[model samples]
Target: MGFEEDALLAESGLIIAPDPESARLTRTITGTDQTGAARDIRIVEERPLTIFLNSREIVTTMTIGDFPDYLALGFLKNQGMLRPGENVTAIDYDDELETIVVRTDQPTDFEEKLAKKTRTSGCAVGTVFGDMMEGLEGLTLPATPVRTSWLYALARTINTMPSLYLEAGAIHGTVLCREDRPLVYMEDVGRHNAVDKVAGYMVATGTDAADKILYTTGRLTSEMVIKTALMGIPVLASRSGFTAWGVEIARDVGLTLIGRMRGERFMCVSGEERLVRDADPAAVAAEDPRSRRKGSRD
Candidate 1:
């Protein structure tokens, strides 16, 4: 069925979940490289999307022009606009207007929330309310283990996969993994958007998070750490470094935080008790050249 038909069904009762394939928009553009060489290259298309909740305008975000419905839902979910178990009536996306309207059963009043917005360090510049951390104290993630073998395998698998980041440069990726297998891989200009899409996908599908690991190419910033904890996911891994605040929160909430992961090496900054050193570091092979990301050099 078409999106309009599916949207109607969603308004009736069903929620439209995000599929991994829905988040890709590619275009070819001519650019000049070093040595004054002109080349035609495919790039990820980006566009601004203004989202409205019911009749009130919420926020505007630059997205990769894919999965508007899921991106909208996920953005709201992470921003603390939509509460858990809140009935999402319908999500309508208009391509021509570049807008998405999400209808919910509960009424939303965000005048105060919008007034207290703060810009984050996310690549696309993520914003959150001053009181966004209000409910984080009550969230305690499950006690999940990060097996050495699983970590090695997951990183290699994700690195080798054909993704939007590999397809076009200048993008970040987030993956939801179970042990050695990556189930959902999302990429966007902003790391927050990528992770939010994964969050929205989880909410729509009712996926359990207790045993899952959240991986990202973005830094382990406070926002990333808090979002993963809110999703009830216990483990967070990244190929980047961590902020001090990010480390403190993870340590306090007992979220296993792993960073600087390249090749066969990684550092778990917090929740060290959850890591099982089952695989020998010497036995692990070097990172596959094809699996390296543009942003991993740091």
Candidate 2:
């Protein structure tokens, strides 16, 4: 399909989408199959990306090395290192050093916060510094109504879209959607990185998240719930299951949490009141077998 046609197929217009064909993102390696036959397979590449906030080195993450700027910005933003309405003067990246530095108009320091890092369950060893719920106090997400129809449509469109996860099995995807239309699709070695990339995009583009839906291929964990709430997005859906803490946080923060979204079936653990059951499950098309990913049935 042509670019426009592909865009229309994925319902991703003008916004960022995964480029699985990019050489820098993946590499071909020789391996043996179950039959012991020699085969060549493409594997997603993970590299260290050190992020610096002004003069302090914040943290280093393992990522697929695409949209480094967005990842850097989003990481800082979600971590509360970069405050809302904070002026970002420049974002400088060094390809050779695999480091990205986000420079704000004012100098910043987070030595104490960095000292209290908590390892998360995300693949590639995700880390969250300080209290996991630091910035969520007194935070209230918009009470945006999510249509069942939009959820179904978004699932079909996003699952079938060409993505790094489908291209290489090791990756995870996080999509920012406005109702049924996906705006930005991001993928990385860690789902947190994908979330941060979308967060960064929203920060850079000045996109409002009060009405947006976050669709992810990873499990609905507390980290995911916290990040979605911090981004000001009302809805978070996934094709995977949820963690108890994740559900609890969603309930506390009043964020809609939907999981196990596949083949016209989903479970909303929190914020079910906001769901408008406008779509009939019988009328929704069954998930295509070709669209199945690693955790589609989980």
- Highest lDDT: which candidate? 2
Residue-level lDDT of model 1, residues 1-298, one tens digit each, is 5545643543353433323233347677899999889999877778899999989898889988767776888888888888877888898889999999999999888888879988888777898875757668766777888898999898887787777677677888888887877777778889999898888777766677898898899999999998888888999999999999999999888899999988889999998988999999999889867669755786
lDDT of each: 0.82, 0.88
Q: Report the C-alpha lDDT of model 2 over 1-298, residue by residue, as the tens digit.
A: 3324434544446557668798989999999999999999999998999999988899889888988988999999999998766799888999999999999987786778888989998777789998999988998888999999999999998888888778878888999998888888999989999999999887877777888999999999999999999999999999999999999999999999999999879999999999999999999888879778656868
Q: What is the lDDT, from 0 to 100, of the residue 95 in candidate 2?
A: 98
- Measured by TM-score, the strongest candidate is 2
Clash list (residue pairs), candidate 2: none
Score residue 152 of candidate 2 by CA lDDT.
92
